[model samples]
Target chain A: MSGHSYDAEKYWKANLRLIFGSLIVWALVSYGFGIVLRPMLSGIPIGGTDLGFWFAQQGSILTFIALIFHYAWRMNRLDKQFGVDEE
Target chain B: MSQFAINIMFVGGSFLIYILIAVWAKAGSTKDFYVAGGGVHPITNGMAIGADWMSAASFISMAGIIAASGYASSAYLMGWTGGYVLLAMLLAPYLRKFGKFTVPEFIGDRFYSKQARLVAVICLIVASLTYVIGQMAGAGVAFSRFLEVDSTMGLIIAAVVIFIYSVLGGMKGITYTQVAQYCVLILAYTIPAVFISLQLTGNPIPALGLFSTHLDSGMPILDKLNQVITDVGFSEYSADVDSHLNMVLFTLTLMIGTAGLPHVIIRFFTVPKVADARWSAGWALVFIALLYLTAPAVASMARLNLMTTVYPDGTAAEPIRYEDRPQWVKEWEVTGLIKYVDKNEDGRIQMYNDASDEPGTAFQAEAEARGWKGNELDVNRDIIVLANPEIANLPGWVIGLIAAGGLAAALSTAAGLLLAISSAISHDLIKGSINPGITDRGELLAARISMAVAIVVATYLGANPPGFAAQVVALAFGIAAASLFPALMMGIFSKRINNIGAIAGMLSGLVFTLSYIFVYKGWFFIPGTANLADTPANWVLGISPLSIGAIGALVNFAVAFVVANATDEPPVEIQELVESVRYPRGAGQAQDH
Candidate 1:
């Protein structure tokens, strides 16, 4: 433990913040834009339909993929910054 | 080769590949059997996870569900895929860092209570078993339709094939075999979709083609579809009839349940590092999105194509004569999935909204004027994906490929789920709790036996499926969403949640979700035993049973917090363990103890 003064608590806090942030986006794209706020988004058309339908069918899933990768990439960087990454 | 022969060749060749992989990857130890010796590359594990996660439902039935339900069915797409986001952020990496073989093992060790582990095992078994029944049923349907055998006989064949690979190689074999299955199923799914897309909109990308203009109608594909369906008295293709709350809850339940499922959870355990666990979740969705993105295109296109086949000239044109229906309809008719009643005996198929409660007076007058008695075509929704290639008149090889793909989807998922059940019984029950001193070899034998038994049970249930079994599959997600997910997430995230609180929360969630479903679905799913009809009108707070898991999960979290506050906190050492799991450091060194 002495070899690494990584501040594990601080690292954990950063990770939680990242998770919380990403999850908000995750919820917004899928449940918010896709379902509840769909009518609000009906004014913005994507192709043949409104933005909400695109979000429901296509946009949310693509966003989810991007979100996971972003989280993974950021968390890995956070691990390195805190000097807690695996050797 | 003949289409039947081609189908046999493709299916038989895929099984041969599976058995060969099984032999190549036979597990030498429990470690190998359980988690592929914990050295699987993230990308390989991602593909395996893709195959493992996309069960018979995703491959065979999802497009049909989407096609039938229109906009409302986006819940399945969003719910199923959105769960990976939760898994990646909330569960997978932490669980991988925890370094356990089974989901229940994580719960047992984390809570430091064998009783909690046992409760988790029961939850895993119920969810996995219920989920596997649907897989076996899907496998049976694929086999019977393609092989021209009775569904029971088809199920037996599927059972034997699954038992051979899963019993022999365990996770190691299933992992590689699943990678192969993923390729087959994806190719099978996408090829037809691409062809259909090109035919309809001249767009090679099915996802894009879904929104492109219908070439003949010169209107956006969806707009044309809406007009055609609406004119025939069917709900508009893009209409949102479900209450927005139920839709949100249903999607949330599915997302959480997908994140919680034991089988999907275990795929992360096979990856070596915590970071790999995170990356693998992303890759798995990338692979899954390939099919999921195409599924909507397939659904919408198939619906449009079927409509054109019936009408030919336009919606107002005369329907296809019963005697002149396409070869695909005749072929599917033999399987009893598509039936034509000809209620008016007018020699033309009358397909429209047959719901007695449809209150559109103008539509009713139009139907009466056309001499349509009621909707004549009793087409099973599950048949759409299977019938897609045939309906589109794609090459025979593509049809053969679909048969293989559907089998791959069903078999891969069934194997993954059976492995989950078998591992829980052997590792969680026998080794972790009942007989701690059980030898590694004895445990492996126990695992194999349990897997064989699972196959028989799944097969038997598929053969004579319970009436509620189909609906219960959705409830299985509800149970997982309510029970296992909250317990596991709380165990990882909340150090104050002790064994009592965890168990109490799980039991409450499980019981609450189960009883709510049983109240409407039937007590224990015994047909004719339901206290009330499973209708939205009878629902509490207008929440469909399928969507109640989200509420059940809320109940779980509340009960957990209240009980944790009222009862003892976890030991300090356990709190430290939770802290260690949250960080990504030293994950590579954490071996399965």
Candidate 2:
């Protein structure tokens, strides 16, 4: 029982860490690049406007797609490593 | 065939497909009704979610708002899509592991309090119902404009069709129908965009075309747009907004609100497994991004097109004569969404920014130099998407297709919202509380009845459509963001949050958000009753009522944490449930009779 509990704790901690990291990237891309630092990054042009405009309008959404798929893949691997994967 | 016939064929054909899907996938039992028998594939579920989540606003109005507002309106795109990321990571998988039929069921069980569940149910119902009214009204507009029907008649037709499929097959029917709807709407959206993009930039992909040099002008589309609009006295198209605080908070409000919306959350419950829930959210975004990516292209291109249309040679040249307005304008003029008046009585349309108080005073010099009066065109923002293909002079078939697509977007979301509303009433309010011992058959009957009732109410409200229908949607998002989202997130993450704490958090969040909105938007959105005027001057630190949900969410979290520390922890069994949900190891198919 103790060993099982330990493994569960480890798995949960790993999950939390992954979520925290992904959320950072999420916040950074949308709020950071898209809104807060848009002016600073205006020097870097994408299509017509600056990189920040692209991120706000197009880039953040594409990154969100990649992030979800990446999280699903990474989490599923973590689940198996912890023997927590649903049979 | 006439354009009207083509429009009818397109719309009627889509209706036929929906009815057929309803017959084929008709719900047989309570499980089928609630969560589509829990057998949906990840990709299929994703497409359904795309259709279900986009709503009329996303399809018909969002691009218009973006076209008009430019970079600031990117919040709609980022906020709406970013919510899926939160859902995949924080909510969907855990909820799937818990294996509930409805969102409130999880809340009810997790907090071990009927009161907590009831609060969630109320929030879910209010949000979903308010949101559905917008869809109904949007569908009515689409019908009136395209099919040449009265808007009220259109609402009833839409209602009858929703009743047929949703009542017959419930979520099962809705899921399949939405897949078809997604295809229709996406094609309708992108085809015109592709044509316009090719026209403007020689780029096939609209997303790429936005950045590419315009073939005609030999300059990037955005640069040209910025130059022209500013030349005519509009702000830079891609200029950074004035207040970072409001933008961040507004975008965050939309993100959390999207994640918390009951209709969207319940779509996850339809997928078979926890992992599928995660993958499904990704797939849904993939399908949605097809339209979303095209939308900005559509917006910028449409804005540029409108500008060039009015100013034939350029802003320096003579504007088009009122009598020589294009066929599209003439047609839209009939709908009254687009009106042309020679404000200067010069017989030529002089469309330029006329608002003296707004930021773009540069237009004043241009206007005075050109001998222009106030802007000649009163163009409603909602006409952008509807008028895009016409603006680009795309073939008539594309126009017909867009009509179908608009209806599909509206109907698919309406069905999804109706299902969420009905399930909350029947599953949580009735089966879970009022009569736990009711038979599965009885519950299914109740679900159908409630769905029918919800549709009737939505259609009636849509037809009458109070002056504040649009504002009510902001209320819906506020309720979900402040109340349901915080409660659900806390319930999953913390076993220490007891019923009392959860209840307190929900009530405080809901009340704070609602009162903030009501205080500015008028108590309950009644016009002129506002304690404080709904303007930037009266706002709390310049945070609009529309963006207050983010602060309301913070209040929920702070209050819940403080209250939970002061009170006892949740029960041992509830803690065990949390532990079980965390692992996702034993999540079988959602429990069914």
Candidate 3:
């Protein structure tokens, strides 16, 4: 494999993919379940109240951890694709 | 031991640990002083940074701030952590690749101008100083609260502890000590939270307990809280208060600011490789999570605890007779953080948000029913975390542990900030500019002296302290966000960004952001000097002073880009430097030069 010669476009595209996907989830857990979609999620009770409150307090934070990990994993793969992966 | 003696013993034990760590890991030479010999493990470095980043505000007050204000407060949670992500991605790895001793060194070398380095130095000092003062203040508050002492005495103790370790250890010493501090703090924070969670929700983990059913209420505790709180004319306990636009901007600003914080970013320089820097950030967050996750639970449970204690029958009647209030309530009341007045000459407590004039409103009704004048309880939000365990009637050890944790948070961050400031002074100010021909020994001596000066300043400021923990944290975040972040980003990302552009942008952002806060907050929050009333409603564009840095950052980018496009591109060698910084090629062994 060529050193520092893999596709820049692919790298850019991969970053975009990760960003948008993780952002969508971030928005969903935080905004969707937390506020905007809170009433909609009120039907599915977490313990007693709807899922929205959980999303606000605990869900958003948990999702952030997952999001960062997902990004790290995807970006590592992208790094390998671009031949920028450190030995 | 008396509860006060127990508090002193626990706090004394923590200081002993920090001092021991400092002595064992104290810097041996200039190399050891600057970057911890670049030998730190990713995990250890992460904990060090977590301690370094959490500060007294995060450990003691953040959750209460969030619980009290509702949605507008989510910014602190999302933004502060989000900044770490930005740090990992945009700044840390690249900066580590540059392999510098100080942030100003990066600016000077990248921009190839002493003026640019000077600009970075000024910003670093201002941001670090403002932030360190807050930590000092936090340390003082922590000492005062648990030690049964006045805050001024607490400030002096915090300062002395910081001076001993920070002046002795430098960065190398500070790093190892921070690791210990991180442990002490996390344990201190979690113990009480666990006990409270178990009591309230039958869950051991407070984070999980937040969503669990309340054993007492026969429902999810939050629902019960909302029901009871709103019945007394309070907004639903779980309701959101901030608009989406403000929340997003506020979070973004904090993220950007956190990423930009000179002290936290400098922690990455302690590790060996670019990969270590990346992993170090993840680790730091993990350590931070140990406390962060527990904080909200502590907050929610604490709020619930306070309410229940105040209103056993869920109203003003027989409100825990003033003389019969819990030991914790009596203890905190003396701090002036909690106040009670038998205004009606009644022996009962009537705590309600009676600000609403609408007679039919729940709060007004509760007040009228109870013969209360207004929201009688004036509990300071900062006390929520510190007083939670005691409030719940948990064992003495848990309360003692919290005292240790709050001190750890303040000390670790203070040490980190001081190191950043001192390194900038010794490396950039003296060696780089004041006396380029200074010997290695001289540089080392200068570094030590500078560290001493930084500690003295931090100690002095902390001793006096600006009084508010979260507010001070916001100011720290605002300055860091406004100035350092933009300069660092442009330095690495834009090769064509000339020294002029970098300096101009930094100065512009710094002056704009600081002056904006000052216009409303008065010069240094010295009351009677504020030209405009200081509140969210009076802010320009409805942006809180906390959010001004985000706007300032935009100005920085705009000024930088326009200037860069107009100027000639950076020299070929500079471009090479940029490319090398981008990829970690041949950055295998970070030399101890």
Candidate 4:
């Protein structure tokens, strides 16, 4: 029980920070690069289309998979750190 | 062997496997029925989630939608899969820690209000029922095609298959069955794509094949598709969307709605731990991505193949004579999905966009010079995927595999949705409220009965589909986004949201979304009774009704905070519950009364 609250608060803060960062990449790939900023990035071609178009169809899905796995890996580490992991 | 025998062998063989699994894993208790004994491995559960999440729409119709609409349809691909990121990060782990059987049970307990639970149930039922009707209809189509039965008989056949395994094994049965289904559907979806990709781009991997150079044209496959489609007077394959705001909002609605849906969320419950739940969501996306990544390749490749078939000699030159069309066209023609009429008294099939009003008048002028009166070839979008094997001239076994695969996609999702609906009735409504003291045996019986009832209702609706059956997918996602998702999120993340506040938020979201959709689609989607047209000019802020759910969610959050701040905070115990759920500690098998 030593430093339990302190560790929990720290763990949550870290988790939230990780989540916040993940979401930024999430939004950047899907909504930002995929939709809104598409025209600006239209000059950079990929697979016969612009980077934005790739992000919209293919890149966003691939990025989303990475984001989820990354969150899972990081959160599992956080769980161990905070001693909140189920044994 | 004939094609009919091969299809039956595949479909019948798959059905036997499902029934054997269901019999082997029959549910002995409500716990097994509800959460599959709450000991499912994350990867196993993830495969089931893949099967559950990818419905008939994803398997059969989505590629067709992408093939038709091109870049604008990316919203469906990205929006659907992107929600898993939200699910893994925002919802799944905590809900698993909360240790509940049904979604509304969590809502009811977290909010400390029966009203909140009931609202959650309503949202789950409405959204799930609407979604399942489409699946039933889709299964019917697949059945009629392969079984040579009318769609009504096909619907009944689908319902019986769903009832057998879902009622027998419950989640345990469905979980294993869905793993089988995932394999079948993925093979069904990707094999034809692989063959077609190899044919077009010399790449067996469909996702990469999409970007590789077309072997015949010596240009990137997408570039070749764009040129081919534009030559036929269609818009550029990668054209920018007309309304970016609507696209953003539409994608947002699908994401949040995907996160909120009861069927998808419930799959996480079957996992053993909070950490497993998180990993399971990631695994689910991995399986789903296998199909999703190939879908664009399938869509673009199928479209190019279709265009080339029609204009055998370029569109500038003469098209092939109608009588000289390929075997695939004639095969599809018997199904009435493809039709060709001799326009301008020409024997050749002059298939091009003949619309004079569009900006591209160049194709129209060429058509006029070629003495074409109208677009003579009418191809249904649904045929793009269904006829893909034939289009690629694959063997009979592949076509049979596709038959079984389509049914697997439809049946797997239908069972998942039916489970969600039945559990809401048996566990949440019956045991939680109507008969709180009901014995475990009695509740299990009730669960089975409701599962049977739900299947009957689903089949009936699927057989005699409403005119707007196709349009209700947006409604399903809209309600889920507006009502259940916000309420669940607030219940977990906001300790200050009292019962009154949670109830207010749910009602506001439900009413706002429902009214917006009803105003455009008519009350209950009764045709010709809408207050205003569903066109873009009459839209609020140019946001279509499909995109209004994102705004509705904002309304929910805003209303929830205002009401919560004005009123009282949630009780101390509930606040502590939120704290406990936030961590991964002490999650055991889901508790049964």
- The 10 consecutive residues of candidate 3 chain B with the worst lDDT sum are B584-593
Candidate 2 off by > 4 Å: A1-4
lDDT of 3: 0.77
Q: Candidate 1 regions off by >4 Å?
A: A1-6
Please write out the lDDT profile of model 3 over residues B314-430, one tens digit for every residue. Answer: 753456678778888888887788898777777777676666653337467556665766665688888788787786677887778888988888888888989999999999898
The model with the greater TM-score, 2 or 3, is: 2
Query: How many clashing residue pairs appear in each of the predictions shown?
Result: 0, 1, 2, 0
lDDT of 1 at B244: 89
Worst 10 residues of 1 chain B by lDDT: B584-593
Report the error of model 2 at residue B226, Å.
0.3
lDDT of 2 by residue, B1-593 (tens): 89898999899999999999999999999999999999999999999999999888999999999999999899889988999999999999999999989999999999999999999999998888788889999999899989889999999999999999999999999999999999999999999899899998999999999999988889889999999998877888998887899989889999999999989999998888888999999999999999999999999999999998888899888989988889999999989999887778989988888889887887697688778878889998978899888888988889999999999999999999999999999999888888989999999999999999999989999998775677854787788899999999999999899999999999999999999998988887778898987788888888989899999999999899899989998878889888888887878888853
TM-score of chain A of each: 0.91, 0.92, 0.85, 0.93
Candidate ranking under DockQ, highest first, comes to 2, 4, 1, 3
Which tens-of-lDDT digit does each residue in B390-490 have in candidate 4? 99999999999999999999999999999999999999999999999999999999999999999999999998887667776578899989998898888
- Sort candidate 4 into its docking category: medium
lDDT per residue as tens, model 3, A49-86: 56876776666767776666656666666667666666
TM-score of every candidate: 0.97, 0.98, 0.92, 0.99
lDDT of 4 at B472: 61
